[model samples]
Target chain A: MERGTQPVIKARVHVGLKAGVLDPQGKAVEHSLHALGFAGVHGVRTAKSFDLVLDETDPGKARTTVEAMCQQLLANTVIETYRIDIEG
Target chain B: MERGTQPVIKARVHVGLKAGVLDPQGKAVEHSLHALGFAGVHGVRTAKSFDLVLDETDPGKARTTVEAMCQQLLANTVIETYRIDIEG
Candidate 1:
């Protein structure tokens, strides 16, 4: 909390299949929901999120680092999209 | 969309591991990030989300159904907590 000391920042990344992509897993879950008596449920899709702690002071820099991390490892941009949220 | 007909509702369920739960996978991710030179990253945690389309008109009813779905299928509540969001 002191000036010039590294600040801990929190961030969350959400990754989901891109629009127009086939989601067979989603379809299967929908069927299961219907069978379980959630009869009117449909159009099920899934996503994964990561919560991170960063030893950075600047929110901008933290977002930049996390964005790079997503690009390099977390997301498959070819068929998926991701959204990042930063919390101070 | 017609009166007396089922209305499609959008809902999202977010399931996350409870705090204090050991997250070895998160640790592994932190290590990987550090190895890749994001040295300041730590305390990484993960979660999953499901996007659902429900054929229910009432927002309250849709949320109730989604909550039940989370209990019955989407989440393992022993060590996890879930949040549900509905979009009209």
Candidate 2:
């Protein structure tokens, strides 16, 4: 399948803070959860997801493009890691 | 399995904007993609994920607990819906 004529591809990107990176937001949530009586829960990590739809049928190409997107803009690669899942 | 003695369960919560909700962030990302020559991409939506480790063994119980977490804190039910995946 060509680029424009390709099937619709969905890319789900999961961006998360790297281990040892300080996450104030996650810490705040953990505190709130504890206050709410969820003490048994710990190591709470907050992450973001991006759902992108592209007119591309090739999974490899889609992954490549979205991975670039993640590195360039979708995520801050300095202190974050991203996992991309592409499906048609 | 009992509450405190149960194995640790992982709950992945995906929170996404509800249909018909205005997504300015997604729009901004779409615009950026177009500027980057990804014109074939459209209908971008931004979302959040919460990875929680709970000291629970039963799948059903874990789901119930995480669903409550979503309703009470993790998600804004008015303009967002959350899906919880529990794993041991």
Candidate 3:
């Protein structure tokens, strides 16, 4: 409720399947690429991204905390892997 | 022409937004959580995952090569982020 107050900082986390897993969507994309006349395209894979906003004062701490969030809450280490990128 | 040859290995990639970014899908999930009477859920973020199959002889080399693939083809560092997990 203050004028001139800096709003909270936010970070975005991108999590996707690692290479080696069977990606039907990616395979479809590859097929489409060939159909679209992109002959140079040999293999294709796809991934997803997410956007998040957190209430934190420090960027470093925020990154560490977010990593923990990814490890514990967001990603499944057994099947999937994730990476976090912070932007202010 | 071999009768018993090992099948190619595959990898999966998971990409998502950072925690600070705004995620509408995550917001919807959060709302649903609250509607379902699941209190204590402050924030929710959404992300996507992909599965990939590559014909590589070495797993380590495959991971390195996939990292390059992410940096070059898969993700846009300016607005999006991504991670790679390898499986054989």
Q: List per-model TM-scores for chain B.
A: 0.90, 0.87, 0.72
Poorest 10 consecutive residues by lDDT, candidate 1 chain A: A1-10
Positional deviation of A51 in candidate 1, in angstroms? Answer: 0.5
Sorted into a CAPRI-style docking class, model 1 comes out as high
Please list the residue runs of candidate 3 whose C-alpha ends up more than 4 Å from where it truly belongs after superposition. A1-6, B1-24, B29-88
DockQ of 2: 0.75
By summed lDDT, the worst window of 10 consecutive residues in model 3 chain B runs over B1-10
Q: Weakest 10 consecutive residues, lDDT, candidate 1 chain B?
A: B1-10
What are the clashing pairs of model 2? Answer: none
Between candidates 2 and 3, name the one with more favorable TM-score.
2
| Model 3 CAPRI quality | incorrect
Candidate 1 A-chain TM-score: 0.89
Q: Higher TM-score: candidate 1 or 2?
A: 1
Best by DockQ: 1
Question: Candidate 3 chain A: worst 10 consecutive residues by lDDT?
Answer: A1-10
Ranking by lDDT: 1, 2, 3
RMSD in Å for candidate 1, one decimal?
2.7
